[model samples]
Target chain A: MNIKHSLLNIFQDNPTCWQLILDQALYGYLISQKNSPENFYINPALQEHLKLLLTDFKSEEFSFEIKEPLEKSEAKSIKTEAYFFLNGKKIASKKAHFLSFSFQQEEFYIAVFSSEKITRANAYQKTYDVGLAEKLKISEKAFQNNFEYGATGMALVSLEGKWLKVNKRISLMLGYTKEELFKLTFQDITVPEDLEKDLSLLKRLLDGEIDHYQLEKRYYHKNGSIVYAILAVSIVKNNDGLNLYFISQLIDITEMKRAEKRIKKLFKKSKEQNERLENFAHIVSHNLRSHAGNFSMLLELYESQLDEEDEIITMLSSASSNLQETIEHLSEIVNMHNSIKNTMESIAVLPVAKKTIENLSSQIQQHNLKITLAVDASLKVKAVPAYLESIFLNFISNAIKYSSPSKASFLEVNAEVEDAFIRIDFKDNGLGIDLEKHGHKLFKMYKTFHEHEDARGIGLFLTKNQIQAMGGKIEVESAVDEGTTFSIYLKKTT
Target chain B: MSTLKLTCIIDDDPIYVFGIQKVMDVINFCESTLIFKNGRDALDNLSSIIENNENIPDVILLDLNMPIMDGWEFLDEFIKIPSPKKVYIYVISSSIDPKDVNRVKRYQDVKNYIIKPVGPEQLSTILKDFKEDNFS
Candidate 1:
C-alpha cells in the first residue's frame, strides 16, 4: 500500500483529524542517521505543538534521543512501541513504525508516530490543579485580611439586617465588641431618624435598581452617643441570584458634623452682635446730632443778638459746623448699614454721573481739571438713587481734589456693561496714591494719603461701603507718580 | 408787620423753642404764636381749639424725637380728627435719616420736611412761601 494514500484515507475519515493532530496529538515523521544521532528532522507542526508543551523546548531545532532499542532483522519495515526523550526526560511515548529505504546507496531511517496521551497525563493535570488551588488560597487570605483589618468600618449583614461578620473598625465605630455586634441587627443601633432612609436605599439595592448606595446617616453607639457616618452599601447575591448578605462600609464623620454645627452657631452669634452694634451706633449718632443742633441754634440766637462781630462767636460757629459735619458723616455710615436692603432701584448711570459732574462743575473749573463724561446713555445699575449719587459725587470730587499739580489734569469717566455688572471706570490723570505703601489703608476711614485740606478721609470708606451694600465693589489701580484709575462694579439692570 | 395769623412751634428742646420764638419775633412771622413742649401737648391743645372753633394755627411746625408722643404718632392721631380748617403740618427733625423724610411723604397733610438748626434765611423763606400759599 502506498503510505501517502493510507494517510489520506485516515484524514478523510475524520475531518478534524488535522486539528486533533496539532492540538491534542503530535504526529510527525522523523529522519535519523544512526551514526550521527543528533541529525534529526522534525516537522513544523510538531515543533509548534512541542513549543506549547515543553517549557525549555527550542522551536527551530529538534534532538530526539530514543532509548528503546530498534531491531533491523525480519523485514525492511518494523513496528514497535517506542519512547522519545530529550535530555534524559521522556516527553512522549507511542506506537511507531519504521521503514528503511536506500536511495543513492545511502541508508536512512524514517519513523512515523502519533501520540494523544501527552495532554491526558494524570501527573500534569494533578500538578496544574494543585497550583490553581494554591493561588486561590492566597487570594482568599488577602481578602480575609482586608475585610477584618481595613481602616473603614466594614460589615457583612444578612438579608434580614443581621450582622454576620464585622471588622475591628466597625466594632470601634459603633463602640461595640465584635461578639456584641454579631448579636444585634443593623437596625438596632441605627438612629431612628436615619433608619428609614437607609432601609429605602437598601431596598433599592436589593431590587437591582442600583448596584450600590451611599448615605450620610447617624447611628447610636454603645455609649449612647450619636455616631455620624457616611455609609456605602453593596449587595452580595448568590450565583443563582438569590438574596445573600450585604457588604457595607462606613466612614465616621461625627467630628465633621459637630464642627459644621458649631460653625453655624458661631455665624449666627456674630451676625446678632453686628446688628446690635449698628443699632447702638444709630442711637448715638441721633442723640449727638440733636445736641449739636441745639448748640447751633443757641449760637445762632446769640449771634443775632450781638451788635458787633465777636471773635468767640466766629470760633464757636466754625466749631459747631465742624461738629455738625462729623455727626452727619457718622449718621450717614450708621444709616447706610441699617437701611441696606430697602430703597434699591434701577438708576440710569449717565444721568447720575452728569448730575454729580454738574454739581461739582465749579470745583472742576477751580482745580483746572478737564472732566469728560463718557458714560453710556443706556447703562443702568441696581442701586439706591441717593447712594449712587453720593458714590459718583465722591469719585468726581476726589479726582478733582487730588488732581496733579504739574501735569495737565483730566478726569475721564466711562461706563460700560459687563457680564452681570456695569463697570464704571474713573480714569484720572491725577496724583495717584502710593498703592504699594498705603493700599491696605486706602479705603479705611480717617486714613488720608494726601495733604489736601478737604480730605476728610471718609469719602472712599463710605464709597466702598455703599458699593458693597449695593452688592457692588470698587477696585483701584495706581502708581505714585503716574495716574490712578478707579473701577466700580455694580449690578447691571437689563 | 406780622404776616397773617397764628403759627405754632412744637419741640421738646427749650433752647430750640426759645431761638425759634426769637426768630419769629424778629421776622414778624405771625400775628399770634403758640408753643408746646411736645407732640402730645400740641395735639391735645389743637384738637380742643378745633372743637371750640377757635383760631386754629395756620401752620404747625412739628418736631420729631420728642419725649411724649413723637411727631409720627401725633400725625397719626391728628390726621384722623374731622376738623373744618386745614392745618398745614411741616415735620422738622434733627434726624438726617432719609427714612424719616420718606415717611413724611406718606402723609398728605404734611406740607414739607426740614432738617434741624433752621436759620433765619430758611425761616424767612418758609414764612414767605406760607404767606404766598395762603394768599394765593
Candidate 2:
C-alpha cells in the first residue's frame, strides 16, 4: 500500500495512510463498532494507518446513539431516526445528526443529510457512493428545469424573501440578467403596490397561517416597465418548524389584460347595437302599419263615396294623394334605415357644413333666415357625406319652417370641442317649444306637437336616425314662445 | 243598441270633423250628431247632461291624441260617471301604433279603435253591430 494525496481516488483507486487516518477518525466519532462497513473494508494502507494511530491511544472509537426508532413503512417524506456525529476535531465539536431511512429491502438503511455533512461521512464509508449522488443531483436539476421554463416565473427565496436563486426565464421576465438579480432580493424588484400584499402573505406563511397563496401582482422590471403576473407562492419548511425558503411562480398576463379591455369594448358596442336594432324593428313596424292603415282608410272612403257623383272626383283625388304620401314616407324611412347599415364615411365637419349651407342657400335666402356658422377647422367627423348634408339641411330647413313670422329668424350654428367629441349647437331665437311636456314625443314619427302646417313631425325623427347611424347624437332644448336650440354631438376622428 | 239621439265628433281638425259628419248623415248613423273641439268640452257637456238628467250619446267618436284632453283621459273620466246604461265608445285616430290600439283595448267601455280618417263604411259596419235596426 502507498500513501495518496489526491481526493479523487481516496476511496477506490488508492487507499492512502492520511485518507485512512481521517476515515477512522470520522467513523469512530459516529458509529463505534456495531455492524459497520468499516470493519469489512479494513485493508493494507487504511489498516496500517488505523493500527498506527491506535498504537499510542487505548479507547473504543464509536457507538450508535439512536434519537428515535425506525419504522419499516413510513420511510418517505419523513425521517425515522437521527444519527449524530460526535467528534474531537480542530473545529468546534457539535452533535451533527442525519435523518435516516431504511433501504428497499430493509437490509440496508439509507440516510439523508445536507452537503455540510460531507466530511463526517468519510469514516463511515471509503467509497463516495457516486452512483446515488449523481442520480439525486440529476433529479434536482430536472425539477428546477421544468419549473424554470413554465409560464410561471419561478424563484427560490430565503425565509425572509431574499433571492437566493432564480432561473434565467424569471430574470428575462423582470428585464434583468441572472447575475444581477441574484445579488438583489425578491422584495427589491417587487412593485411598491404589491409589497404590502406580499409581506402580509409572507407573515401568514411564517406563522403557519397558510401553506400556499395566489395573487395577481405586479413587479418592476430593470427597465422600469411594470410586469403584471399572477403569482403563486409556496413555503418550504424545515424539520424543526422553521421556514427554509419560499418558491414563487409567476404567470404574466399583460397581453391578457389588453385582450379583456378589447372584449369589453366590443361587448358594450354590441349591446348598444342590440338595443338600436330592437328600436329599429319597432319603428319599422310602426311606420309600415301607419301606411297600411291610411291606405285602407282611403280605399274605404273611395268605396263609400262612389254613389255621390257630385263629390266623387274630388274625394277620390284627396284619398289617392294621402295614400301616395303615406307610401312615400314609408319608403323613405326604410331607405334611410338601410343606408346606415352599409358603411359610415369620414368627412370634415367644416367642409360638410359649408357644402350643406351652399346646397340649401336658395331656401335660406327664400326664408331670409340669417345663418351664422362657426365650425372649427380642426374637427373631423366620421359619417356618410350625403347623410351628414341631409341631417344639416333638415335642421336648417326646420329652423326656417317653424320660424316665428313675427320676429327676425336667427339660427346660430357653432361647434366646439368636447371630451373626445365635437358639439355643434344650433341656437335659434325664433319659435320655441313647450318641451317640459312634449319633450319625450319630439322624436316620435308623425307626432305633430306644433300647429305648423308643414310639421308632419317626420323631419326630426329622421334626423335622429341619420345622426345615430353615423356615430353621432342630437339633443334639442326648446321653450314654448322663447326659442329652440339643437345640440349635435359627433365623435371626432383622428 | 238603443236609438241614438245625438252622435258627437270630438276632434281638433275641422276637415276630419266635416268629413265624418257628412258620412254619418249619409248613412243616417245617428240623429242630431253634435261636435266638440276637445275632450275638455266633451267632458264638460257630458257632466252638464248628467246634472240635467239628459241621456248620454248612444255612440261616441273619440280621438286618442288631441289638444287639452285625449281619448284615454276622456274614457277615464267617463267611466267615473254612474251612467244609466252602457255607452258604446269608439276611439278614432290617425296613429297606427299597436301600443295605442292595445292600450284602448284595456278599457272595457271602448267598443272599438277605428283607424282614420273615419269613413262611412267602417261606421256602417259598426252600426250593423248595434242592437237597434233603425238603419236597416
Candidate 3:
C-alpha cells in the first residue's frame, strides 16, 4: 500500500491517532538517547521488555501501526498488536501510525501510542481557541451604548476641567446640541456662584480621598436660563493608579426647587400675620378692661356721693358713654380683621364716596369746606361693601374734623389707576399732623395724635387695618398746619 | 396714725384722675397731692425736688400707658436718682395682661400693682397700711 494513503486512512478511522503518535515519538526519542543502547526492535521474546518499557514510562496502554510489511524490516520486530494490555487488561486499542527508517541500510520501526481518553484531551485544547480580543470588543460596545443613551445625564471630564465625553441627555438638559457641548468645558456652563463648590468636589475626587460626592447646584443653559440639578461625581483611575478622569451624573431638580421657595414665602407671610393678630388681641384686652374698670369704680362712688347727686350723675353718664364708644371701636376692629375672606366685591368708588359724603353732609357744611370730586364715575375697587362705606366715611369726616380754622377748608377726592392699584387721594386743607413726632404710631390701635375730643384715635387705625385686610395700603403726606393728603391704594377690579 | 405727707399721681386719663382725687379727699388719704400728666413730667418734677433739697412724695401712683416716657421707662431712670428718701411706687394700670403684671416685678422700687379704677375702699386700705408701716 502507498504510505501516504495508508496514513490518511488511519487518520480518518481514528482522529485521536495524531495526538497519540506525537506523545509516543517524544518518549521514544528521549529513551533511546538516554540509554545509548544498540539497535532496538520489537519481537515476541522482547514483548515483555516493551511492557517493562511501557511501565517505566507510566502509561496505561500502548498501540502501534506500520505501513511497510513486517517481513521487509531487517530489525527485530513483533506481530503488531492493535491493542496493548497492561496487567491482564486491554488498555490500548486505538489505531496509530508508525515510522520506518534505515540507518546504514538496516531498517528500524517506531510506533506511536497513547493511553488517555481522546475526548478529554480535545476539550482542554479547545479552551485556548476562543478569541479574547473579539469578546472584549463586543462587551465594551454594550457598555458604551448603555452610557450614551442613559436617561440621566452622564459625562467624563478630564482633570484639567475639560469635558472629554458627554451623553445625549446632558446636551438636551442644557439646551445645547451634542456638537456644541463638545466644544465647551464644564466651567463654561456652570453658574458663577456654584462653580467654586463644584470645583472643590472635583479636587477631592482627583485626590482619591473620596469615592463620590453629590450636591444641588445651578447650571446656566444655552438660553441663559438657570437649570437646577443634583450632580453626583466619582473618580475613575487608569492602570498606573493615577488620576484619569471624572464620571459625573446629573439629575434635573428645577421644578422641586421652585416649589420649595414658594412654600418658604408662604410660611413667612403667615408668621407675620399671626404676630399682628396677637398684637391686636393685646390691645383689645388692655383697652376694654380699663374702661369697664373705670365705669364700675364710678358707679360705686355714686352711692356714697349722694349729697353731690347732680355732679356724680354727670360723671357717671360720661363714663358710660366712654365705655360704649370703646366697645364700638373694639368691635369695628375685630370685624375688619376677621372678615378678610368671602366678603370682597367690585364696588363703584364714585357712588360709595358720594353716599359717604352725603351722610357727612352736615359736618361738611359746618366746616365750610369746598369739596372737589375728581374721581371717575366708572372707577371701581375690590373691597367689602361695609368696609368701603366705612373707609370713605372716615376719610371725609377726618378732613372735616381737622379742617383749617384760619382759612376756608378745601377738600379734594381723586382716583387714578396705577398698575394693579386704584390710588385714591383725599386731599384737605386741614390741621396736618407733625408726622415726624407720631409717624411710627400712626396705625397703632388706640394711638391718638390729636387732642380733638372726637379724634377717638380709632378711625385711622381701623382704616389702615381694613385696607390691609383687603390687600391694600394707606399712606399720608403731611406738614404741620400745611394740609394733609391721605393716599389709599386699593387693588383695581378688572 | 400720720397721713401720707405727700402723694404723687402720674396718669394721662382725666376720668381716673378725677375719681382718685375725690376718693383721696373723702378719706383724707394724704396731707397734699402732686399730679402729673405722664411719666416725663413726674420724673422732671421729682428731679428738681431732689436738687432743691425739698421733700419728695412719700408715695407715687404710676400709670403704664402714658403719652411720654411710660411707666417702665420711668422706673429704669428713676432708680438712678440720688435722693434722701425712699419713695414707694405703685403701678396703677388698666392692663389686665399677665405680661404687664409680670413686667412690674422687674422694678425693685415698685411696691404693688393696682388695677384701675382704684376704689375708695382700696385707697383707705392703702393709707391704713402706710400708717401701720410708718412709711418704712
The number of the candidate with the highest lDDT is 1
lDDT of 2 by residue, A1-494 (tens): 45456554665556575556655443322322223423222223223323332223222342234455435444453433433221332211223333333443433333332233333445224323443464567777988778667656788888767777777678878888878887888789888888899889889987899999988888888888888889888988777887888988877887897788899999999999988975765554444444445454545555666765546566666676666566556645655555554456666888877887898889888888899989887788777777788888888888888788887888998988898778888888767888888898888888877788888877888788778866779898998767899998887786
Report per-candidate DockQ.
0.47, 0.10, 0.27
- Between candidates 1 and 2, name the one with more favorable lDDT: 1
Runs in model 1 lying further than 4 Å from the true structure? A1-166, A174-226, A229-251, A308-313, A337-393, B4-19, B22-45, B66-68
Q: Which regions of candidate 3 fall more than 4 Å away from where they truly are?
A: A1-142, A145-151, A158-164, A204-212, A287-494, B1-5, B12-31, B37-41, B47-53, B66-69, B76-86, B105-109, B119-121, B131-136
lDDT of 2 at A426: 86
Model 1's CAPRI class?
Answer: acceptable
> Candidate 2's residue-wise lDDT over B1-136, tens digit each?
3256777778876767766766677777887777888888999998788767787777788987678997778889988988775667888876555467678889988888887756667888778767453455
Kindly give the stretch of ten consecutive residues in candidate 2 chain A with the minimal lDDT sum: A84-93
Better of 2 and 3 by TM-score: 3
- Model 1 per-residue lDDT tens digits across residues A1-494: 88786997888787798655545533555667655666666544445444444545752343565545555432565766555566666665656567655545655666666433333344356435665576678778998999889889999999899999999999899999999998999999999999999999999988989989999999999999999999999998888987788999999999999999999999999999998987777675777787898889878888888999999898998899989988887888788866878789988999998889889989888889998888889898999998999999998998888888998899899999889999999999888999989999999988999998988899999999999989999999998767899999999996
What would the TM-scores of all predictions be? 0.64, 0.41, 0.47
Each prediction's RMSD to truth: 9.4, 22.5, 23.6
Cα displacement (Å) at residue A444, model 1: 2.4
Q: Against the true structure, what is model 2's DockQ?
A: 0.10
Model 3 lDDT, residue B23, Cα = 79
RMSD of 2: 22.5
- Number of the top-ranking candidate, with TM-score as the measure: 1
